[model samples]
Target: MMLPKAAKDPSCGAPKHTGLLREELLVFRHLLGLGENPSQIRLGPPLSNSSLKDILFVSIDVDGPRDFKCAENSPCLVGISILDTRRLQFYMTTISVAAKTRSALGNVENLIKSHQLQVGQSNHLSYRSSKFLFGETRQIKADKVKTYLQRLIKDRFFVLVTYGGGAADCIYLEGLRLGIRPLYHLDVLKVAQFPLQTYYRYSLAKILDALKLPWQDLHIAGNDARFTLHALLMTAVRDWNYRDDKPKSKPTPSTQVTLSSIKTIAKAWRIPDQDQPSLSFLFEDHIIKERVLLNPETRKNGKRLRPEKTPEEKAQRRERKKLAKEKRKLKEARRPQWLFNLGDLLDNE
Candidate 1:
């Protein structure tokens, strides 16, 4: 398999193989037990279309620099989940490419270090789950990611399925101008709407929750890719049954986890610790420069000394100030007597 050509490559023509529709591929993945364990899989009724056998289901997710440009300079982590329907087998893997530039390399290091911190902890699932999830992980230079993908996708009729929009995993491939010719492009995010009857969008984790399937270590490329594939399969099965008007009692449940009550978290799309910094630390001037403040006296030792007060507290403080002013005047009126007492004490000393 040749590496995908740049956008200007004349030899790269339009894709020749356009396989199944998004709808058909979704249903087919479910029936073939694509993402399930072989021991647990009990094959469902086959689809009418025999052509589905020839296609490969490739679901992918990527983790990269926050502001991604070309893949060459920036770091790239590609997670791929492949379902070979023809052979009734599936594989998950990740390809990590280090950035060429110092800044981009720092970003990559921070990302991996962050994930590594949660490795053995129970609180959050980390990329280390990739081993338990039984996926291979490879580290290479940023340029080689495309080559790896090209080799993996060689000659076979394939459908490229992704959790989110084209702007995600697809954009990296397109931005790098890696000439991947997929038989079909499927966005599970869009395909899921009608099947799941949801007007709102879903993240990969949220969708898995809706389907009553278990997902761990999201944003970890391989785990995300694997879950995305499973979500696709489950959504496809639901859509197929809904179209067939199958009885509610005969619903197909996911094989990975027991079909428990479906639960979804609000604001599930936002990853924790993803908020943008209030101040960019890249510029030294931004940190050292004096900032205009309403009360300059309130700032001390580079910290705010004054606490914010309510309206009632302010009124009470004003009343106290008035009392203190009267007391000070009374003390001043007896200043001569106090000075005389001080003189007598000095003489005794």
Candidate 2:
């Protein structure tokens, strides 16, 4: 299956000779042993006849608690980096939706604030300010996270790309029951190894540096997703033959398109420039916090509301109180006159 070489990739303005090939992509997939793991990869979706441009590359990175066990139990920040190869454009959405409870406020606030603090300290991708900086940080309900993802991948065949083989992202998305699945699964971490020739699982930041692709603020789900997709594209363009040569600093066509698209989308959002602290409130789940605070009796810790006592239980409580009162009266009646006099003397003193 010899695929044609791209003459000119308008996305990055890269030379035709260095452009990506579909055959190269297939070879890359095979080299990574992607087809061997049916449990992790789905190869039966008839991608053989499809050109690389025909498939959507969806890169997902989810941010949850450090102890993130599963998406169901934890609140997730979803970062979706989408490359529509046909259009030669990129679309990204980094969602920071907190659970509809007051309990999520502290953690969500800290994540956004920490990222805000590190915005301009370094040129490294790890310090890349999020697209949210240019756009209004809109809040959405936690339940809507799945629907938002579904809307993006609907009516499209996408290849799911992620760092660390996306085991957690798969569980998170599947747990949401997205229904739509990727045509193929590509791991940027594994894809990177073929070029770097190491079994060690390097961090996405390190892999991006190794591939000579620019990375932005990492750990933020959206930025991570964007990085993952670009990393996969850059890895695809690499020659499988081992080379001691260091990767060039030039950005790929896919990366160029991604950055441009981000700016375009940010411009469309028309968010006014302000201090980071001022914008931080938008990312916080204030609506949920406000709702939770309205009830005076409600615990701020997000515990379940106490149910009203049943008639039988109330009657039992009353009975217990009566018995306690009677017992107290009996004890008082049994008290010695000397003790009563002593208590009177102490009170007078």
Candidate 3:
């Protein structure tokens, strides 16, 4: 429903534009292009049929591939990915809520690798900011979940990326409440490559397998997050063709209304728990450091996360790398010979 304009404030007798105020006009919606003609502010494509390009995305997943509705119950592992398609940049962080008796902190190195956060061959910024909360009890864990989540997003615009039938309605709604503009890709894997599917709806494992990602920590909360991103990228890039600014396809009629106010829906989300916690504590901050891939030289727990390379494994890896390099060269060779445009090439990358 369209909001009525400028209701009178009870106290000061002023017009309140955005939301109703019992006392005085506090804030207003700035519909810059609004006019007497309804068409003026309403002219735009609906969301159902949007394409991915130059878009910002935040994909989230729970560890153990658990239902988001169960958040109040068991431990919660929250993986958040920030993807900037325009720059081909991806950043990822995962938070796991375990009992104080169990290992609460996850490996920053493995989390990064499993999540596909480190894009390209090194040199990009490796994000490592970690702090801890004392959530030994169920209630405490729930609060911790919210605490870390708010910190992770930090008010940047994001679309809630996830795998499955729905966007885990509660998490999506919660994110919206947090004022994070959440986007959904609930159909990334719906069109199964085969008919008699054995996988769950929008299964992350199956998607990873299709992408040829060497899977590890399948249901691990942190891994699920990075996998969601890698899977999305793989699907998006396959047989890819690019065009500038494809128009949004109209949203399905049933969903058009729900999505219409998505941007402003957060206005009704619960007020933040508190501006700042009564007490602040820092636990751990995992970082990828300078190396994108697991460095054979770096060791954790007196052992490297990546196994020592055998001669055969090394040979096979080299062969695969060589073939990939040759394919890249072949693709470049097929490009139409043109004057080098550094800016365009760099921008596209």
Every candidate's lDDT: 0.51, 0.51, 0.37
Q: Give per-residue lDDT, candidate 2, residue 5.
A: 32
- Candidate 2 residue-wise lDDT, 8-28, digit = tens: 224645444332223324533
TM-score of each predicted structure versus truth: 0.46, 0.45, 0.36
Residue 98 accuracy (lDDT) in model 1: 21
Instruction: Report model 3's TM-score to 2 decimal places.
Output: 0.36
What are the C-alpha RMSDs, in order, of all predicted structures?
21.8, 23.3, 22.6
Which segments of candidate 1 are over 4 A away from where they belong? 1-51, 89-132, 244-349
Error of 3 at 332 (Å): 53
Show the lowest summed lDDT stretch of 10 residues, model 3.
23-32
The local lDDT score (0 to 100) that residue 87 gets in candidate 2 is 43
Worst 10 residues of 2 by lDDT: 111-120
Best by lDDT: 2
**For model 3, which pairs clash?**
63-221, 115-226, 130-285, 132-283, 159-183, 160-183
Worst 10 residues of 1 by lDDT: 258-267
Q: Candidate 1 residues 205-285, lDDT tens each?
A: 788887776665677766677667667666654554344333446444332111111011111122223233322232334
Index of the highest-TM-score prediction: 1
lDDT of 3 by residue, 66-113 (tens): 454553444344455554432221111112112221122222212222
Could you tell me how far off, in angstroms, the CA of residue 210 lies in candidate 2 after the best superposition? 0.9
